[model samples]
Target: MAAESGKIDPMHQFLVEPLFGQHLVVGGYDISFTNSALWMVLTLGVLWVFMLGGMKRELVPGRWQAAVESLTGFVGNMMDANIGPKGKAFTPYVFSLFMFILFANILGMLPIGVVGLHAFTVTSHLTVTGVLAVLSFSIVLIVGFAKHKLHFFSLFVPHGTPVVMIPLIFLVELLSFLVRPFSLGLRLFVAMTAGHILLKVLAGFVINGLNAGPGIAAIVSIPSFVLMIGITLLELLVCAIQAYVFALLTSLYLNDAINLH
Candidate 1:
């Protein structure tokens, strides 16, 4: 019965399929190139093109050059606002992080022509997002320890509290600190997953209803198609928002590490 249903599974698109002939396992780990890896490479390629092309020096800046400058300035301002002067040192990392995420998202939204192993969203997977989150968290931890040494542990203890509540406060802060990575990763993963699922279900209704339902069903699908278009547009905005939010939070964490409360 389940096989006969032929329903569209939104999750099917998020599957990480190996791009090579077969899955390659070295030692106990699978490091084979996957659709997600392909997309990540493609994302980097897109950044390379923008960065390289934007290098033109002319009296009047071209579109690509202007775009590149604008994006750089925007992120620079965000860093300055969040992390202050020290943020300049981390601009490259933050800029690259923002661009990688933004491009990854934009690529996934593109209506590229390819089947099976194409058009995967890296951020849709918790593994990918988790890695990014951990990288950000590690940066914060390392910076905190390097700058303050044993005093870094003070971040988990509130500056001022009653003597009796100190233990409870420390426990609460420790739990909150530990959950940062999971929260960051889950935010992106869940948002991408939910938006894609809604879009897929709406599209499936339009396709399946038209092909396999009564005349009334065909009529009902018209609105579904319209809603699908609207949702696609919203998802585009969401892609940018999620990337910005991630980068913003990373900068905030850096700021906290640099000037602990």
Candidate 2:
């Protein structure tokens, strides 16, 4: 819906616009550098610097090295506990997943301006999250089939089902399995999008209130500003929790595929 007069358009923030003045078209398709792409690349670059720059040989680690080491150990221990000893073999992949999502989430919180607009969050897009979720599911599917061959089909069959109910049970399980990617992607997309919308609305209220007559604006702005601050802090916590949840769910799915449970 278009924004009505006198109200802020919260959804406008999610619109993807070309970074360059002129849009780039190639082979009848638009292929322009966008705010979303820019932020994604920035996040990747930050990760590269953090991880590689931390590889110093000093016995007494500096702040940067210490932070990198701590993050490495945190993800490493998460895999060890969640996926057990075999998880170490997949540590690189799982750690990359965790870091990528973590960085993307944190980067979205930045106030940096980009191409006349504020930062664009790649994870705020359903397509981006959907791709990540599908990629994780694909890894699980490939690993499961490689390890168990035709027996991987048994994943949808309950171990001790009565003969007559096998077909019904299989259908239900298969449906659940098929929806995993959608569910995983939707969870992150919805959480981030909703939080941003709520923040925008509260911010709008504060702005609108302050623009009124001085005495009235002062009175109204106080509560709105306070509420906005509370939401901002809550969002900070949500950012970390969502990233951990995505990584944790991926690991759990991997475990199910490997152990066929």
Candidate 3:
């Protein structure tokens, strides 16, 4: 039905268009405000609002407090389990990253279209996720070099490798280590992008079916709608899992820096 009139572009949702028809250039770089940036700020605002909910600090926790504490505690435990005693100092960073990514992801899945609003997922872009991955990798490098100096290079070598095999092992490990940021960023971006594309295509089916009238609506739209709901639920789970995976990988990377193992 939709194809009769026009084809829906699944990639349309991922386009980062400038907002308000305003463009600015700073140092030859396009610094114009974009829909992606807007959603990121909104994500932060939403996160801030939630954080404020737990500021009551009651002796007995309320719903908001429990929700906030649960998230914080989950990240705390993850850091502890992954990095041990040294991980305690890094809990704040891990918690912030986890919360930000989680909220950003969850916000993208909001049914804003019901109110004629558009939803954009920042994590769906490699640029955003790549920056995050690089940030984590940068911190690991800084900490590693600061603590161990020249010995930091040993991170590429296995503990029990024979001297002759050390060269090959080190090269392999080095390549793998270098690929971490790319892999990390690409994982989240790909997952979010693919899921959103699938959802968008299904949504097109729903709209087209409805527009085609009752017969097509019942046949095409209804099943697509039901499947969309299931996929949306799965996407929500993916949101949490992706966030956790990112934070977990960061902690494990930090573990190498702090513990040198």
Candidate 4:
């Protein structure tokens, strides 16, 4: 039974598989629609339906409309708190980012495998998260330069650094600033991947224990099954927390650009 479970490849789930036999190439780029892309489309479609729930304009909102308002209001308040008065203008972008990531993360946790469909966690991929991090950072750079011009360079130097230490401090601050995107992307990718790998390994254990014997099932499979349930709940909480952390950090970074503090 251990051998049987050992044959299960935990990492195989992360593999990007193409849905179609045919391929599309443009400028030497393989733009083929993959399982990852299909899930992203599903994520977007679900999110769109969720948003439409709020369009009733009723004086008293039902549960679905209330949920929509709650999320939007939460994101809006986060921006106001993080970026201050000027944050209102960027609310749309930040809100979109928060919802997309939240939905993507949650969608991956759905119990789709029971229906002969495997859910792909898009956030587990570096390319997707890196693009999001870069896009956020790019906006910061654009806003900083557009508003402050060369004065944006002042961001690297502290307001009261001693003359002798200014150079060292500037270098450290610059390095930290430059690493934001890499760290942001890496954090989410590592987190999502680790959680999924752990869950898959636990599942393998359950399967193996059941097949090994009734004794092994009582000793291992039942416990493993219970543990999987607990971890699943924890992962769901983590999904929301990570999404909030990413959005909050982005807002803070934008504050630096907007206020140059």
Task: Give per-residue CA lDDT, model 1, range 1-261, as digits (tens).
Answer: 011276776667788878867989999899899888888988899899989999787679999999999999999999999988988988888888888888888788775523432477888889988999999999999999999999997888887778899889989998999899999989988998898778777867876778777784658688898898899999999999999998998898898898886
Per-model TM values vs. the true structure: 0.91, 0.92, 0.95, 0.95
Q: How many angstroms is residue 71 displaced in model 3 relative to the true structure, after the best TM-score fit?
A: 1.0
At residue 235, what lDDT does model 3 achieve? 100
lDDT, model 3, position 131: 96
lDDT of 2 by residue, 108-182 (tens): 877553234486678889999999999999999999999999899899997999999999999999999999999
In the range 1-261, model 4's lDDT, one tens digit per residue, is: 113424667887788878886677899999999989998999899999999977687899999889999998998999999989999989888888888888999999988777777899999999999999999999999999999999998899989889999899999999999999999898888889899888888888788888889999999999999999999999999899888888999999999999999
Instruction: Kindly list the per-residue Cα lDDT of model 3 for residues 32-147, writing each as its tens digit.
Output: 99999999999999999999988788999999999999998899899999899889988999899999999999999999888878899999999999999999999999999999
Model 3 stretches astray by more than 4 angstroms: 1-4
lDDT of 3: 0.93
Cα displacement (Å) at residue 258, model 2: 1.0
RMSD of 4: 2.1
Candidate 2 residue 123 Cα shift, in angstroms, is 0.8
Q: List the candidate 1 regions with Cα displacement exceeding 4 Å.
A: 1-6, 113-117
Q: RMSD of candidate 3 to the true fold?
A: 1.9
Q: Residue 238 of candidate 1: its Cα lDDT? A: 96
Query: What clash count goes with each model?
Result: 0, 0, 0, 0
| lDDT (Cα) of model 4 | 0.89
- Which is the better candidate, 1 or 3, if ranked by lDDT? 3
TM-score for candidate 1, please give it.
0.91
